[model samples]
Target: MSIKRILPLLVVVLAGLGALSSGPLTAQERPGPLRIVIDEGVIEPLPFAVPDFIAENGAAREYAARITRIVAADLQGTGLFREIPKEAFISSVTSFDAPVQFGDWKAINAQALITGAVSVSGRRLTVKFRLYDVFSGAPLGKGLQFAGTTASWRRMGHKVADAVYSRITGEGPYFDSRVAFIAESGPKNARVKRLAIMDYDGANVQYLTDGRALVLAPRFSPAGDRLLYTSYESGFPRVYLLDLGSLRRRALDEQPGTMSFAPRFSPDGRTVLLSLSVGGNTDIYSLDLATGKRRRLTSAPSIEIAPSFSPDGRQIVFTSDRSGSSQLYIMPAGGGEPRRISRGKGRYNTPVWSPRGDLIAFTKQNKGRFHIGVMQIDGTEERLLTSSFLDEGPTWAPNGRVIMFTRETAGAGGTSALYTVDTSGRNLRRVPMQGAASDPAWSPLLK
Candidate 1:
C-alpha cells in the first residue's frame, strides 16, 4: 500500500491510538486550533513547546534529555514550527502523567505542547509521548509508546517527532525516512565520490562505497533493501544494482557496445527503467530483474534520458532533447508516442514523479542560471523553489511534501552541498554535512 493509506493504519495499530478522522479539516474550519496550513505564501510558524522528557530511572536520564532535544530539533527544522525556549516556560513536567498547565502555555502563546518520557532497562529503551492543543485545553491525540534497542534511540526520537508533526500539520510523516547520496571529497580537479545513506535529518551517515570509483544518482528500491546507481568504474557510465544488506554490487546492464545509466525502480520493484546509449543514440529501456530481458521504450532520434515511473507504474516522465532543447515528456510505460509537458522558457531535465502523483520536480536552466522547480503533471502552474549557480537532481521525500537537491558554489574553491525545500517554496535550508555531497535520493519510510 502507499504511504498515504498506511499512515493512518500505523497510527491506529502501532501507536495504539484511536481511529483518526476520515479527513483533515480545512484551515478556515480549524482556525485558532493546533494545525498548520501549507499555502503558497509566507506562513507564520506555529509556536510549540517540548520540555525535557521525564527520565523514569537513573539509566534513562541521558537518553531522555538527548531524545527530547532531537524531537524538538526535528520539528523546528521544518520551518512550520517554532520551539519556545525552555527558560520562558513557567511550569515543568516532572512526571509522565502529570497534568499539563494549559494556562501557562497559553500565556506564552504556545499553540501546541508536547510531553514525553523515557525509560531504559538493560539494552532496551522505551519512549512515550503526548501532544496537546493548548487553546483547546485538551490532548490532541492519545499517548503513544515506542520500544527499541538503546542504540536506536535516535530513530525513537524521530518517531515521536513524526507523530507530533503529522498530528499538527495533517501531512504525512517524513522524519523517519532515509536519503541516499553521493558523498564528495578531495579537490575539485580530483574529486572522489562515494555512495552513502543517512537519516532524513542528515544524521547517522553510513558510507556504502569506498570512494575509489565515481557513483551517481543512488535510487532506493520500493522496499528500501536495494539501490540502483550509476558507476564509472569500467571506463564508462553503467548502471549497478547494490544489495544494501550484503554491501555487494554488480553491473545491471553490460552490453559490449552499449552504456546504461540513470536507473530507477518500478513501483513494484520487479522492473528497472534506465537510459541506454548505443552508437551515440540514447533512449529509455526497461529491464526485468528476474530475467535478463531488455525492452526499449523510446525510439526517438534525439536523446531521451532520466525516465521516471508514475506512482501507479502505468506512465512515465522523461527528459528529451528532441524539442531542440531539453524538455519534459510523458508516455505510457509500455512504450508509445510521448507528449511534451514542459513549455517554459528554460531547458528542463531530471524530471521526477512525486510519490503523491500530483507534481513533477525537475532542474531548469535559463539565461546562465540554474533552478529547482516543480509543475503539475500537465505542465501547468510551474513554480521554481530554488536558484543558484548550480542546483539540480531533485529528489522527493517519502511523503512527497519536500524536495532535496544538490547546489554547487561558483569558482575553483566552490563546493557542492545538499539542500531541501518544501512544496510551498518555503523552508529552503541547507542540510548539515561534513563534506561536499550531491545526487540525493530519499527512501520510503521504514517499515
Candidate 2:
C-alpha cells in the first residue's frame, strides 16, 4: 500500500437534502468514471459545438457566452469531448428554439450541440440550456433551468450542464457543490490553520475562521450549511461546531478537562462522533447536538481515534494501537469490545465507511510510508488506492468511484496539495488549490 492515505479514513454519509438523483455520473458531470453516451458511437473524442448562449435586454451578452465557454470547458475537461472551434461556427444562434443547421455542424464533424440562453433579473440570474443530438437532428433532453445570484452564475451553468449529462447518460450530477478544507500557512512544522470552504474547482474561497488558533479536521454538513471541527482555542483541544452560513459556533461539549478531536457528523446529521482524549488514554464517544447528551462508546487503555459512522449509523469504525501498532477496528455505535478488522504487516489508521456500504476506506502506514486503502466489511480483498510520501485523507466522490485525498510532497519547500484517484489507482490528478492546501473534505453532490 502507498503512504499517501492516512487521514480522512473516516466514513461520512452526506444525505444531501435537495439532491435526489440516483445512478452513476456521466462524462458531462464531474471527473470520475465518466459514462459516455454516444449517438454515433464513435470511439474517438466526440466533437461538440457550443455557440455563445443568447442573452436578452443587454443584461450581459457576454454572461451567456462566458457560461457557454465554461460549459464547454467542463465537458472538454473529461478528456472525452473535442470542442469545435468557435471560428468553425459558420452561422450564429439568435434563440435557443431556432433550428440548428445540421449541415454546418456536420461539416465540422460535431456530433453534439449545446444551446442555451441567460437572463438576469434583480440580483438573480437564470440560465436555461438544452442538449441536442446533431447527427440525428433530435433533442437529446429537455431544457434545464437553474436560478441563482449573479455572483454564482457559473455554478448555475455547471449545474445545468450536469443535468444535461444526467438526462443523456442516465447518471448522477456532481457540479454545483463546495469543498471544505483546512487552509494552511507557514511551514509544515508549525503551520497556522483555519477552516476554509470553496467552490468545487477552487473558486469562491471563504474563510470560516481566522488562522489565529490551531484547527484540524474540518468537515461539512450534508447540507453544506454547517461544519464540525476540533479547535484548541479553549486552551485544550475540543470539538467546536461552526455554522458556515452565519459564522456562529459554540463548544460541542461543556465538559471540562476533556480534549476532543477528529470530529465528524453522523449520517443523519443530528449527532457527532469524536475521540475524547483524557489523561493520556483516548476513547470514542458520541454527542447529541440537540439534547447535549454524551455516550461513551469505547473504554480502553489503548489509544483510539477517528470514529466514523456507517451509512446506516449502526456501527463505528476507528483506529487503535491496541494491536501493538495502529490498525483499524469496528464495533457497535454503543460501547463494547471492538473486533479487529485490519490484520496485516502494516499499520492502519483513519478508517472511514463508504457511503455505498460496500467497503471501509482507511489509511495504511507501511515501511515508513502511508497509503489510502479500502477493504470489505469482513476485512477481505484489501485494495490500496494510493501510495506516496505522505498521502492521507480519503474522501469519497459523491458517486463512490473516486476518492479525494491530500498528498504532501517532500523537500525543503515541500507543500501539500489535493489529489483525486479512482479506486483502481488510475487517473491521479491534482485538485485545484489557492496557496498550499491540505485535508480536503469533498461535499455531497449539490442540487
Top candidate on TM-score is 1
Residue 139 lDDT in candidate 2: 54
lDDT of each: 0.88, 0.74
TM-score of each: 0.94, 0.84
Among the numbered candidates, top lDDT falls to 1
Backbone clash count for every predicted candidate, in the order shown: 0, 17
Candidate 1's C-alpha runs over 4 A off are 1-13, 17-32
Give the per-residue lDDT of model 2 (tens digit) for 1-447.
111111111112222212222323333653322236432334355678888888964885758878887788666644456789988887788876777787877688777788888888776677877666777765564555666667666776677666655654454565556678888889878888888877666766777778888888787676656788888888888888977545678889757877998988888899988889888899888999899999988888999889888889888889999879998888987768789989777989888787777788888899978899889987888988888889897877665656778888898778888887756565577876668788888787754
**Model 2 off-target regions past 4 Å?**
1-47, 78-92, 106-109
Model 2: weakest 10-residue lDDT segment is: 1-10
**Local lDDT at 139 for model 1:** 72
Give me the overall lDDT of model 1. 0.88
